[model samples]
Target: MRIIISPAKKMIVDTDSFPPEGLPAFLPRTERLLSALRSMSPAALQALWKCNDAIAALNVERLAAMDLSRSLTPAILSYEGIQYRYMAPTVFEQSQLDYIRTHLRILSGFYGLLRPFDGVTPYRLEMQAKLAVDGCRDLYAFWGGTLAEALAAETNLVVNLASKEYSKAVEPHLPASVRFLTCTFGEEKGGKILEKGTACKMARGQMVRWMAEHGIDRAEDLRNFDGLGYAFSPAHSTESNFVFLKGDT
Candidate 1:
């Protein structure tokens, strides 16, 4: 089984804690992206990032000095966001780390698809960003079927924990033989399932930790997940889409 999640916008470079396994599989494609980004002025970059002055300035500097080969951090440790914070990889045991290395994947705008231990530099780009590259108008177009092909090479079962934006880069192109399952976390609100952004992020992270802790390898076994007050809801779930609903704690 393989699980895919989105990379966080916020990041920190820490190579000391865990040694990076190797470069990202899509390094060549990443270079093509960096080449386009590097050519943009700070103002243009600011527009592309769509951030305030300070954040844009930081990334402008980051892009200017970005080196794909050196000063890299593990992809898992590099990301710092709500989902990643809830996942809490910093305190994970070695066995859990091993499990993650084998099963977990982080989808990125720059790197395409990244293994947990894949070496990466700090950069800011979202899969939905409209930055045109080559003739492609968006990241999804630029990535094409590459990400899905990579996952298909690994396993037949893919549990998608990634959000719609990043997951679009892979889901549409997956081979017909691949069994793609999307996990949904939400609450029954006014008789309808409502997915709150923060709640879903926390749930996704917690679910990943639960899988690692239990060494879960089968998609069906994911129904056993019970983290952060969530419980698998057969009423709202299907074989292709697993739904976990949270009630009042």
Candidate 2:
């Protein structure tokens, strides 16, 4: 089973924690993207990124000085979003690290798919961004079925812990032979399930850590996850969807 998660927008360089195992699988395609990004002016990039001037300028500098290879941080440690912060990979035991190294895959707009320890530099592209590359209209079109094909090749089961924007790249293209199970972290309202953004992100991170520590390898075992105050809700769950409601477990 491969547990797929989204890459964080906020990133940092931390070469001390761990050295990258290798470069991204899609590095050649990444270089093509790098070329596209480097061609844009700061103002155009700022609009493409939908960020403040400060963020735009910082990324402009990042784009100008970016190096795809050499002196890179591991993909897991590089992301600094709430999800990554909650995962707390820095203190993981060797066995737990090994589990993630094998089971977890990070979805990226720039790099396509990334192993946990894959070498990566900070990038600002988002899956939903409108920046067109080559003849493709957006990142989704550019990636096409490549991500899905790679995941399907690795394992016949994929547990999606990613948001819709990122998951869209793979979900539509996954072959019928590969079973895609999505774990939903939400609350049971008046007979309805509602997913809150920040709370769900925290739950997703915590669940990944919990899964690694426990050596969970089956898609069915995901329903047994009781992390971050979430209880598995059988009533709201289907074979392809595991719903975990935040409250009493």
Candidate 3:
């Protein structure tokens, strides 16, 4: 059955008021990456954080400096940068490396799902890319809305699939317009409202139109939609709705 939502305004999640528990297990490597980064000079790190070029340089530096071919952890770290660009790693010495690489590919491909390329500033994009590598599922969870919320110290909206029980619990509490976030047609190749010109066939114009009819303005307004999980703003009145009709055609 199709579902429609019409939130009067953007549904706000008082992130500070209702913070999530610790990060998920699927995100330990991400944690390690962040921890490792913390050891670097704050000034350098901040520069890197602010400059895309610096971030790219850091990524290149890490891969070149680390011996990924020798161990599982190193290989995983090395693959992190490669995956952000949606490129697969040429080397995989361990099963763990292979596993991590698989996830990275998903993230890179789903890059569009996080935000429209143009809307996400280069610095924010770089930050998200780095955050993706940090074994932080909460960041990965709906394009890291909570993570973003924490970082910006402000409330943020996230969209995810409704199939899970967790979504069910939150659905009723959300505003009517934003009940259903964006629909994910597929993985990696799915819909990413966050990224512009990065939409998949299933999440193309038709989906956007549907959102407009319900309430969604800029494509960037779409946080994430993987068919299974979704999140979006219930405020910013545009259109409110959910679910993709381009299924099993």
Candidate 4:
């Protein structure tokens, strides 16, 4: 399982050949909605950045507990080369990873309302795609507001993804300064899996167990694995949040 992380979408980990389907499906919609946002527009992505930064700030203590798990869990990645299986070497890099992880978590939370967190399942992918479309729409509208309102609106709106009455629930919560935009990417283009085999049959928990069986405990070990690569953040949400805040501030 070769995993490659690139700064290009904030540590996007490519497991086989492409991002999960929901993300790709959602990408073009988001792009079309947010067409006003130029490529890699800092202003456009800032709300997302602030939300992640806030979460990392809350994750500090939770992060400490995770190092212990790394020692106990040797099947996921080989922790032998890394000082702590769950941690990045420098605080800086850790923050980068955390920022990405935190936002992904928020995204997951949203989809959780409608689907399970199945990495490649059709339903999960579809829900993720919907979120990608909806989220970018809201985020782009945020820039017209004061920075604080924009950040708050982005966070709360994203949180709403999991809401049962997202449309009604979010409208009251959103700052009036922000408005939804329309964006699209890829036009629901199909994707290819360059990897030789599939990990689609494996549930996320099963995949983790498989990794543990191999005594793989660090992020780097996936480089030699034959299937997919996953980017992980410790389960401790609070600690992840602390890391987010420390880095973004």
Candidate 5:
């Protein structure tokens, strides 16, 4: 089984935590993306990133000096979003780290797909970015079925903890033989499931950490997850989707 999640927008360079195991699987494609990003002017890049002047300037500087094959931080240690912060890989035990390294995958627009320890540089392309390349209109089109094929090659079961944008890269193109299970973290109110972005991010990260700590492999076992006030809702869950709701505690 493989667990797939989204890449965080905010990132940092942390060489001290752990050295990257190796380059990403799609280095050549990433090289092309780098070239295309390099060709864009700062104004255009800022537009693509959809950020304020300071954030855009920072990313612009990063893109200017970015190198795919040089000094790098492990992918799992680079992202600084709330989800990653909650996952807290930096303090993870060695066994938990090993478990995630074997099971977790990060879906990306810049690098395509990344293993937990894959060496990566900071950049600003999202899977849903509108940057067109060659004849492809967007990142999703460029990635196509590549991510799906790679995951299907590795395992027949996929646990999707990623948002719709990143997961679309794989889930839509997956073969029928592969079992794709999605986990939803939300609150049940007035007979409706409402998900707040920040809370869901926290839940996703906590869930990843919990799964790794327990070395969970089977999809059904995930129903036992009760991290961050969430409890599995059998009424809301189906064969392909697992719903966890946070009630008044």
Candidate 6:
């Protein structure tokens, strides 16, 4: 089984920490995108990033200074978001790290797909960003079916922990042979299933840690996931969609 998650916009660079396993598989392609970004003015970059002045300035510097070949932090350690914080990879044992390396993948607009330990530098681009590269109209179009093909090569079963923006890059393009399953973290409130952003992010991370600790390798095994007050709901779940309710019985 393989699991896919989104890369966080918020990142940290630790040049002295864990040695990067290697560069991203899509380095050449990433260079192509970087070429486009390198040409953009700060204002254009700011628009593309859709962020405030401070974030735009930071990313402008990042784009100007990024050297893809340089030594960098592991992809897992670089992303510092709510999900990553809950996953808490910094304290993981070697065995847990091994498990994560084999099963977890981080989807990115810049890198396309990344193994947990892949070397990466800080940059600001989102999967849903409207920036076009080469002949492709958007990041999704630029990535095309490459992400799905990569995932198919790795495993027959894919557990999607990625948000819609990133997952859309792969889900529709997956081969028929691959079995794709998505886990939803939400709560039942007033007869509706309400999904809160931060809570879902936390649950996604917790689920990954729980899976690693329990040596879970099968999709069906996830039904037993009860991390962070979530319990799998048979009524809310389908063969391809596993829904975990946070506060309901």
How many Å off is the CA of 63 in candidate 2?
0.6
Off by over 4 Å in 2: none
Error of 5 at 141 (Å): 0.5
Point out where model 4 deviates above 4 Å: 1-11, 17-27, 39-48, 51-249
Per-residue CA lDDT of model 1 for 1-249, tens digit only, reads 999999999999997998899999999999999999999899898888999999998998898899999989999999998999999999999999999999999999999999999999999999989889989998889999999999999999999999998888898999989999999999998889899999999999998999999999998899988899888999889988999988632
Give a tens-digit lDDT track for model 6, residues 1-249: 999999999998887768998889999999999999999998999999999999999899888889997958899999999999999998888888999999999999999999999999998899999988988899999999999999999899999998998999999999989999999999998878889999999999998888878878999899999989999999989988999998555
Go through the candidates in order and give each one's C-alpha lDDT. Answer: 0.93, 0.92, 0.30, 0.25, 0.92, 0.92
The model with the greater lDDT, 3 or 4, is 3
Roughly what TM-score does model 5 have, to 2 decimal places? Answer: 0.98
Those runs of model 6 whose alpha carbons end farther than 4 Å from true positions after fitting are: none
Error of 6 at 59 (Å): 0.8
- Lowest-scoring 10 consecutive residues by lDDT in candidate 6? 240-249
| Selected candidate, larger TM-score, 1 vs 3 | 1
Q: In model 6, what are the clashing residue pairs, if there are any?
A: none
Over the stretch 185-221, how does candidate 5's per-residue lDDT look in tens digits?
A: 9988888899999998899999999999999999989
lDDT of 3 by residue, 12-44 (tens): 112222222222322434334545554666455
In candidate 2, position 44 carries an lDDT of: 90
Overlapping backbone residue pairs in candidate 5 total: 0
State every prediction's TM-score relative to the real structure. 0.98, 0.98, 0.23, 0.20, 0.98, 0.98
Angstrom error at residue 17, model 4: 8.9
Better of 3 and 6 by TM-score: 6
